[model samples]
Target chain A: MQAYRTLTRRELARYFLTSTGYIIIAAVTFLIGFSFVVLLLKLQQDSTLMPVTELFYITPFFWLILLLAPPVITMRLFALEKFSGTFETLMTTPVSDLQVVLAKFTAALIFYVVMWLPLLGCVLIVRHYTSDPAALDAGALGTTFLGIVLLGCLFISLGCCASALTRSQGVAAMLSLMLSVSLFLLSFLAKELPGTSSWQAQALGFFSLVEQMHDFARGIIDTRPMVLYLSLTAFFLFLTLRAVESRRWK
Target chain B: MRNGLMIQVANLTKRYAGHTAVSNISFTVERGEIVGLLGPNGAGKSTTMRILACFLPGTSGTVRIAGLDVFHQSDEVRRRIGYMPENNPLHLDMRVREYLKFRARLKGLSRKQSRGRGDIVMEQCGITDVSRRIIGQLSKGYRQRVGLADALVNEPELLILDEPTIGLDPNQIRSVRQLIKGLAGNHTVLISTHILPEAEMTCNRMVIMYEGRIMAAGTSENLQRLMSNTNQVIAEIAAPLADLNECWAQTAEIQQFDVSPAEGEYFRCALTARNGLDLRPIVYSLARERGWYLRELTLTRYSLEDIYVHVTRPDEEKEEGA
Candidate 1:
């Protein structure tokens, strides 16, 4: 428990102390602000009755931020340690592989959440300018942020697994980016197919991030997606633990 | 617990996909003894150390640290061992003091204990001045010292240092040697170095490894005695090389001899005796009787490097023959 805390603390501080962490946050904030400005322009042209926060999720900028931030945030967690040979020093200490994996995963997840905090700022700015509480429905905003957190959990764990598999940060980042892009394509696959009521589409719908976010934006908290995201998060964390343990075999 | 043995290995072997890294090697390190694992590169020294550190698993056999099984009770064993791996990898982004404190915490030290121990180790390693400096910007020698401080922070019973003085200047090497020697009798140290002089200077006993197997294990003097019973005799004489070789070959005490030109009109003859006899007198008298003027004659025992080469050389020849 002490080891886990220390590792997590160190991992978290690394994000704020290094330039890469700030670079990730800066890129993420810029995208979110750009998405906000584009959302306002769309509102002005279409005059849609959509809440600003709900419309924010539909922007390509939001999806792009989600897809790119996790890999950059987690690419160095294990790969950097392996490259610099600190992985050996770390493992030889009195910490279990599970603790190390969980610590890194938690740190990356927290950093992902922090990166997304600027979106809340953008929403607040919308609320302040519109002078209407309904434009930022508290319940919908709550669920939307919850969905974002869940997505971050799964994506960060995937990135952590990728990082643990290799010693190159570039490879880890690329591998996770490919994985996340493929995962995002699942939502596209679900929408492009012919039958919306078919069992295959239903099964695919369960894996769709778009459908989940759509429901979340309208203040729906379905237990099914909640369970799915949490379980997948745990599964990827398990894979990371195994990847870390594989060091012993070599 | 088992007769004060700090480390014990039996029939330990590690086989990768196409090769065996460590092959059925065994050795024991008693408490408070500085044992050096001396070998060339790829001699399986690092592999063996890794297995002992519980960073790598052995294919078969058992490794016990402080009488605890390494594979099964690795966490318990790890608490007692502080390992400084080859190349001394560290988190370069962190300050030295912060890194040491973090390592202490990871090693299960309490907050107060880690702080105190961290300071003491920094002082011990002579890195107190740079404790606030970022490790990435520090000099190599300072970075190496920070690594040492980290290993010592846990106050572990066994210190496994792999090439601790490697890539250091002579002065840095001397200080690090002194630091390691000071650790003896308090913590059992298992250090590895390919430099024979380093082993000779720092270790109480050495396990000489070659090709993933231990070729010899003992004190330097014991290894020297084990390799041969003969001491070498060097004599510089103003004589014909043929006459000198012929005379030395006929001498019963001189088992092997080599003659090379020493200077203008002088040849230097090096001879090994059949027994552990001093050959200086024998060479002097032979030169005096033969009317050859002898300029210098000295009896010198084999050094650690000679003994190391002597033990590891035959296997190379055998492999080439096969």
Candidate 2:
């Protein structure tokens, strides 16, 4: 337990000690803040009292912010260590491969959360603009944050796994970006595929993160999407551990 | 952890896709011994060190560190050993003290123990002044000190440093050697270095490796004796070659001489004297018999350099043959 804690703390400190960490935080914050402002402006120009709160929930900017967050934050987690030759010393330490993977996953998740804090400010702005305060729907905002946690874990896990597969941070980030974009595209495609409007569509919707986001933004807290995200997160984390352990073979 | 043999290996072999990094080889280190692994580049020293550190398992052999099998009991083996790999890789982003603290904790030290041990190791490595400085901003010498400090943080029973002084200046190399020498009685150190003087200066024993095999391992003097029983004597005479040859005769130990006549009035003669005989006095008497002017007659003893070349010579011949 102490070994794991030290590993986690070192992994967390790895971010702040380099320029890349601050760059990641700055880019994510700016993108999220800018998108939230645009979404606010888009809602204010409407004449029919188009709910500002609905705009917050429906905008692609929120999902875009979420999608862009993890790969940048998690790319150097394993890749830099391998490139800088620290991976050998790290492996020879008392900590196991599983601990190293989890520590990195946890650190990326923490950074991922900080990167998404700008969403809270957007939610507050939505609350202040409502004419009927009761129509604000705080429960939906809470579920949206819950959805963010699941999505962040799943995305960060994928990023760590990708980082483990390569020694170049740029390649790691690009690989994770491709995987994330493909998943997002697949989720959108699932809603449009033929013969998918029945029960099968609902079943396929579980794999569609966009559908889950839409449902969660509508104040629907389904246990099925949460379960799917958590399981996939675990699966990718296991893969990261395997990748880390594979260094011993050659 | 400190009770028995520090290391024991038998038939260790590491193979990559199409080649072997380490062939079938075996060696051991007793408790409280400082041994040097001397080899040229790609001679399998680093590969062998990595395997002993439990970073990789041997393809077909067994490695026991502190009496625990490296393959099955790696956690226990890791606890007993501190490994500073080749290039001395460190987290350059981290402050030296911060890195040491993290390493101490990872090595299973308690919070209080980590703090105290980190300080002790920093002082020992002469890097206490730079403890607050970031590793990347420091010179390569200081980074090597931080690496040494990291390896000593846990008070490991065995220390494996692969080419620890590889890229340091002469002053830094001296300090690192002194630091390693200071560790001789307490910790069993296995350092791999291609520098012959480092082995002669610090190691109690030397293991000369070539082509993934140990060509020789002993004290430096013992390995030197293994090179040859016959010593080469160079005799420089100002007298004429005909007069020197007329005085020279083949004795039991002294035989044929390879003579190179100099441009000036000197003949440079080299002789192979068998049984390590001192031929200078015999040559002096012969010169007096012919009244030849003996300018220089010196018998050279083999150093570690000569032994290294002699031991690694066969592979070079085979390579040329190929």
Candidate 3:
């Protein structure tokens, strides 16, 4: 437990000390703010009723940007160390590979949370402008936040696994970006294909993180998406650990 | 299993794609001893060092460091051993003190303990002045010192330094040598270097490796003594080449002599003398008897370079033959 804490703290310190974390936060905040402004203006022009509903409707588009941003933030977590020769130093230390992977994953998760905080202004603006503010679905908002956190965790773990696959940060980032974008598009492709409704739903569901996003958006706190997100996160995290361990044999 | 041995390896071999990088090799390092792993480029010294550090796993054989099996209990082995790689890859953006503390924490030290250990290691490695400076801005010597500090931050029982003094000036090299010498009784250090004189000055014992195998292992004196048979004597005389060759031939102890042209009317003869024989006195007396002007007569002792060359020469010949 002490080793885990120490590793996590050091990993966090490393993230903040470098410009990578700051740049990521600044980029994510600016995009979220821009999307919020665009949504507000569109709602003013098109909606006759509540702007909050429109804001919630448009927020899924932000996941496109969210999907693209995390690879930039997390792809260098282990890849930079491997390229810069610090991996040898880390490997020679007493810590296990699992500790190193978890610490890195947790640190990136924390940074993701901090990045998400600045975008809360969008929610605040929606609540302020709504006439029936009490009618706002607090449960849906909470579930969306949970879903966003889970998605972030999944993306971060995938990025970590990609980083561990190679020593080049650019290559890692490219691979991670491709993988994340492919998964994002997989659900849409599944929806268009003709099949039995249940099979189609399952196929689309596997690709659509947004299907899980929909449950959260509708104030339905379903356990299935939560399980899916947690399982995917664990699988990628395990791959990262295995990638690090394989270096010894190489 | 020896009582005083700090590290022991038996038939350690590491192969990649069926090509052996480190062949079957074995040696033991005693506690509190400074040993040098001397080899040329691509000699598998780095591979052997990595195996001992547990950074690279050997394909076969056993490595025991401080009584712990390297493969089975690598975490425990890593705790007891510190490794400085050939290329000192450090986080250039980090301050020296912060980097040290980070390494301490990674080695599982507590906050207070990490701070204390970082302080002591910084002082010991003589990087206290640049503790606050970013590592990228520091000089090469200072960077190397910072690397050493990180390696020592865990208070490891064994230190595995791979070409630690590769890029340092004479003065900095001297200071590092002094520091390693100062650590004589506390840390069992294994340093790899191709610089013969540096090894001669710093290491108590030496292991000469060539082509991924241990060619020789012992003290410097022992290596020198082992190659005593190849020792030669150079005699410079102002006499006829024929007379010099005949004179050398007459001596029973002299195996052969090659007379080469020197300055006008002077000849330099290289005489290969028998084992444990001193041909200087005989050459001097022969010059005097023939009324030859003897300019110089000296015995040439075998240096570390000679031993390395002689040891590896056969390997190369066999390679060519195959």
Candidate 4:
């Protein structure tokens, strides 16, 4: 536990010291903030009684931030270590591979949360602008935030796994982009295919992170999507740990 | 197994797709000993050092450090060893002190202990002045020193350095060498370098390796003595080649002579004296009798380079036959 803490602290310090962290945060905030304004204008023009509905509708924009920001932040987690020759130094240390992977994952997650902060402010702005703020669906807002956080965690883990596979940050980022996009589109592909492929539908539905976000967006705190998101996060994290371990043997 | 033997290896083999990097090599380092792993490029010095540091596992063999098997008890082995690779592996954005403290923490030092140890190591490596400076801003020599400081943060029992002074200039090299020499009695060090002089100056005992095997391992004096029987004499004489060869052929101790013309009337002749012969007095008298002005007369000794080339020569059989 002490080792993990130290590693995490140092990893976080490194993230802030580099330009990547600031760039990621600024980019995500701008994109999400822009989407929030667009949604607000559309809602105002329609004069919908429920202003929070548009806020829930804007939740999908966070996925764009989730998918893009994490790869940028996490691709260099292990890839840079390998390129900079620190992987050998880390391997020779007393710390375990699991500790190293988790340290990197936690740092990326923290950065993800900070990136979400500006979006949180957007939510507060939506609440303040509504005439009847009390009518706003707090349950939907809470669930959407939870879902975005879970998806961010999952994406960070996937990026970490990709980074562990190679020393090239560009390759790691591309692989993570491919993996996240495929998983995001799995539900749509399953719907397009014919036959009694209920298994494929169930699997894709279970793995489709964006689909899970839909339930939260509609103000439903379903246990299934929550558990699914958590499991996906854990699975990818385990794969990242395994990839790091295999590097030693090679 | 005794008090001095800190690391021991037997039949250590590491193979990659039928090509062995370190093939059945065996050696041991006693406590407080600085042993040099000398070899040409691609001779597996780095691979061997990596295996000893537990950074990589051997395909087969036993590596015991501090009396613990490397493969079976890697965590324990790692705790006892500090490794600084050929490339300085560091987070360039982090401050020097912060980086060292992080490394100390990773090596199982407590929070307070890491802080204290980081300071001591930074000062010991002479990087305390740059402790707050970002690693990327430092020069290569300072970066190498910081790497050394990170390795020493845990105060491990054994230090494994792979070409630690490789890219440093003369002054940096000397300072780093002095630092390693200052660590003589406190830690058992195993340094690998293709630079023969670095090994000759810093290491107490040397292991000469070639083609993934130990060609020779002993004290510098012992390795030098192996080639000491065939003596070389460099004599500068103010005489013509004809007169020098006439005197040299008559002297039974002169096994072979190669003469090269020097300035004006002087000639530099390299003489290979017979085994166990001292021809300095004989050459002086010959020059005196011929009234040849002797500008210089000195017997040459074999250096580490000579031993390195002699042992690892491609034509070892032919050279031995000669």
lDDT of 2 by residue, B27-119 (tens): 999889999999999999999999999898889999998889998999999998999999999988888998899898898999899999999
lDDT of 3 by residue, B1-322 (tens): 3248898999999998868889999999999999999999988999999999988999999999988899899989999888999878998988999989888887888889999999999999999999999999999989998988888888889999999899899998988888888887789999999999999899999999988899999998899998887668998888777777778888998888889989988888989888768888888887788899998888887888888888878978988999
Across A1-250, the per-residue lDDT of candidate 2 in tens digits comes to 7877788888777777777778877787777677777776775675444344445656666777777778888888999999988999988987899988988898888877776776777667667876777655678677777888898998999999999999999999999999988877777777787787677666666689887877776777999889989999999999998899886775
Q: What would the per-residue lDDT of candidate 4 be over residues B1-322, giving only the tens digit for each residue?
A: 3365888899998987768888999999899999999999999999998888887889999999988998889999899888999876788888998888888888999889999999999899999999999999999999999999988999989999999998799999999999999888889999999999999999999998888899999999999888887788899998878998888888899999989999988999998899857779989998888899999999888899999998898656777989
Compose the digit string of candidate 3's lDDT tens values, residues A104-141: 89988888888888656777767788786664667667
Q: Write the per-residue lDDT of candidate 1 for residues B1-322, one digit (tens) a residue.
A: 4248999999999999999989999899999999999999999999999999999999999999999999999999999999999999999889998999999999999999999999999999999999899999998888888988888999889999999989999999998999999999889999999988999999999999999999999998788788567688888899887898789889999889999998799998888988778888888788889899999888777789888898789978998999
RMSD in Å for model 1: 1.8
lDDT of 2 at B155: 92
Q: Fraction of true inter-chain Cα contacts (below 8 Å) kept per model?
A: 0.91, 0.88, 0.83, 0.83
Worst 10 residues of 1 chain B by lDDT: B224-233
Question: DockQ (C-alpha) of model 3?
Answer: 0.72
DockQ scores of the candidates: 0.85, 0.76, 0.72, 0.66
| Models ranked on DockQ | 1, 2, 3, 4
TM-score of each: 0.96, 0.93, 0.94, 0.91
- Highest TM-score: which candidate? 1
Candidate 1: segments with Cα more than 4 A from true spot:
A197-199, B1-3, B275-282, B319-322
Candidate 2, after superposition: displacement of residue B133 in Å?
Answer: 1.1
Which lDDT value does model 2 have at B4?
Answer: 73
Q: Which ten residues in a row have the lowest lDDT in candidate 3 chain B?
A: B1-10
